[model samples]
Target: MTDPQIERKLIEIMRIINESDRPVGARIIADELRNRGYNLGERAVRYHLRILDERGFTEKHGYTGRSITLKGKDELEEALIGDRLDFVITRIEDLIYRTDYDPVKKQGNVIVNVSYVDKDDFEKTAGLMRGAVDYSISPRVGVFEEDSEDIFVPAGKVGIATVCSITFDGILLRHGIPVKPNFGGILSVENNEPVVFKDLISYRGTSIDPIKIFLMRQSTSVTGLLQSGSGTILANMRSIPQSAVGDASLLFQQLHESDIGGLLAMDNESGNVLGAPVDVGLSGIVVSAGVNALAVVEEYGIDVTTRPVSTIMDYGTMKTL
Candidate 1:
């Protein structure tokens, strides 16, 4: 059998060609491979294209020298899921002054506050955001956000964060805007395990135009980060709306603001943060809620929130709990 790695590469090449709106040439594919630090020659790329055609993954056009096929699209979608792509969406809020203000030199800054979720969930949310952006204003460029910290694993964790940027013709106009003809397909796992997905979209403004303008600014900021070697992940993701009752919007906010090791203080009445436990040694903490529980304030009584509290630990230096 052919090496799985080599087959994977061939599949990736086909996917790239299919995902591209315009038909791409073999030379262009070869150049892209070279830019990615691969020593793939144009002849080798052409050979792979022929192989793909034989396998029914791609087809050559009658008159045009370029080609694309449904098989190619399916292969590309599979690759996108396997790779676990990362993306970012920024909402811009432009503050216009009543009097004369320099629009060019001085501009209002729009901060896109990001909340953490599972990698799959993040991709799904990003896809929806991209669709909104595409349908609203048709943005020419976009920014990418990189994962700076290590992936949170149960045991023996390593420091490696995947990030990437994609430039497409789209812009997300409003906060509560709904996506038409949703592109977010079936979100499933290889082992058939259930996964949690959340969508967090926020905007604080009166005018929609200024918000759209601010989105452009925020996109620029994210773009800058991607260009500066901070964002490094693949493109192509699925978009889903925030409609489920179990979305953990508030908890995510608390996690983002609190210190890495701080305790998650819960409010009994509102189920929100009354305050966190400071200077308290925590062994470990597990935050959980209902599968579709939206209002976590009172549901904490019915749901589950568990954590390990450490007692009698020396704090001056590193000591065992």
Candidate 2:
């Protein structure tokens, strides 16, 4: 086998072993490999198994079979990193399908972004978050202290779960409207109103979260917006079918009245929204990014670790911050 082919086969074998509940034998490994269209014979499987053992990527259990080691798992993840380039958009779609939040009835789970800050900075973090320039999904937030298990809070760190704007997509899906997230951008704001997009990262093209990249660069001026009503803030652009425009508008109004509003602007008639063009037959929408509040905290020079579009949480657990 060529070098590349050898690596691929070894990685596949490790994956099979990692997925099995018990030690996996060469015969089963060969069968599983065949199911994946590898066409590897039992002899080839045993040859790869020996290579894996020599590399300390697998362990022999006397007569049982072989199991993947921690080193093997690490290697697998590194090898498959290229396959995860579209992980962000994939995760968002999955969450959208899982979203069951209802605006009118006000129940069910919604998606949220999780951030961790030092416990010593918790009070200050809350204060900064409260000044998010009104670009967040909603005023509701979930706070998990150091000892809380609802979400992982590292030692001496407090976890803050902020409402993700993707909740809008989920809500719309529940109402028969499909949403396609296009990109995340730094939206210019003037006099507390959204203007043009200053910079954008296509959701379909990147591996890392765009908002996280922006925050790390300190590229957002959320504090400026809060103080002077003009600056750049994180925002996401999405599209819906033009046929659903009217119904979507009414539903968004109901959402606002229900205090779950996040819709910033919708452009169906013009097909141009803040300098970003919408495709034909689709209406463009710009919604507030969920991690904007966390960005506010970061702006204050307080350290924060953010995980955007992180998890689903019960709506009832969130309270006004």
Candidate 3:
């Protein structure tokens, strides 16, 4: 076949077109590609569109641009499967005998890596395993995806961020949000009341004109949106209610105090991006929850404008474990 990378991009383009409500031009497709971590141009995207059209995977509507066909849909699903199987099978082999499985619980942790590190340094760090399990060694068996408790990051400049677990990732993926590791600015926006529903509807606050905010359990809202960079997108992200959960400021506080990495909310119905929020992280972002993108590099905080604002690390899936 063609180079795997090219083949992947061809499928990716097909996938993007498949997800859109209407036919989208190459520019919009290219923008979506970049948001999902592909650095490509509209010209390059159109080239692939042409190839897909030739393959009968995409169809053009005069000047309305292209959309994916049924054959393309089948191809995309197969692509997602083929892309992940190798890694999943390898990780499975690594922990074939070490994990606890429950078909009912569906909870399990895979031993992804065994590495040596400074023992003193690991404990000094917050939000780690801490006293949860027995330690006493320089080598760490690192493969617990996340901690059970919610991690709270203080509000500040660029150094701050809202981290979510794989549990949260699946929710957004089921929504319109693409399931991929990504980092980008909100391109534009149209503000409205936020909701807790994955359907991207079902209101929480009616009189709260402008912001129909709610406490987001499954998804997250990063301060760095509105400059979505892509075309107008109806964004449904994870967010917290304006009121803290009991004494807990929760994730919403991070978005509110954002001098950097914070919530850039989007209205899902209108499909219009709202105005971009100011740099709550003009100084930086705080790690408000979970692990993964835990620390803030110095240069990144200086000015998150060009990039490194909010970060997301895609966690692998769970199989019967």
RMSD in Å for model 1: 22.2
Superposed by TM-score, candidate 1 places the C-alpha of residue 250 at a distance from the truth, in angstroms, of 35
RMSD (Cα, Å) for all candidates, in order, is 22.2, 8.7, 19.0
Which candidate order results from sorting by TM-score in descending order?
Answer: 2, 3, 1
lDDT of 2 by residue, 17-63 (tens): 98666888887777656533367888989999999999999999987
**Residue-by-residue lDDT tens digits, candidate 1, 1-321:** 666556756865774576345666676666545422345787888888887888787777643445568876776656534322211121111111111111132222211111223333444433433432311111111222332221112111111111111100011112222222111111111122212112111222121221223222222122222234221111112121334111223322432232111112222222212121111221111121111111111122221111101011111111111
In candidate 1, position 217 carries an lDDT of 26
Give the TM-score (vs. native) of candidate 1.
0.29
Residue 306, model 1, lDDT: 12
Q: lDDT winner among the candidates? A: 2
The total of clashing pairs for model 1 equals 21
In candidate 3, what are the lDDT values of residues 1-321, reduced to their tens digit?
A: 668778878976886677556887787777656544467898898888888999898999988889888988887767745554343323222233333322123333322211111323333332232221111111122222212111111112111212232222232232223222111121232242322222232112221101112111212222222223122212323322222222222333332232112233422333232332212211111111222122111112211111111112221231110
Which is the winner by lDDT between candidate 2 and candidate 3?
Answer: 2
lDDT: worst 10-residue window of model 1: 162-171
| Candidate 3 Cα misplacement greater than 4 A, ranges | 85-321
Full-model lDDT, candidate 2: 0.82
* lDDT at 259, model 1: 14
Candidate 3: residue 300 Cα off by (Å): 37
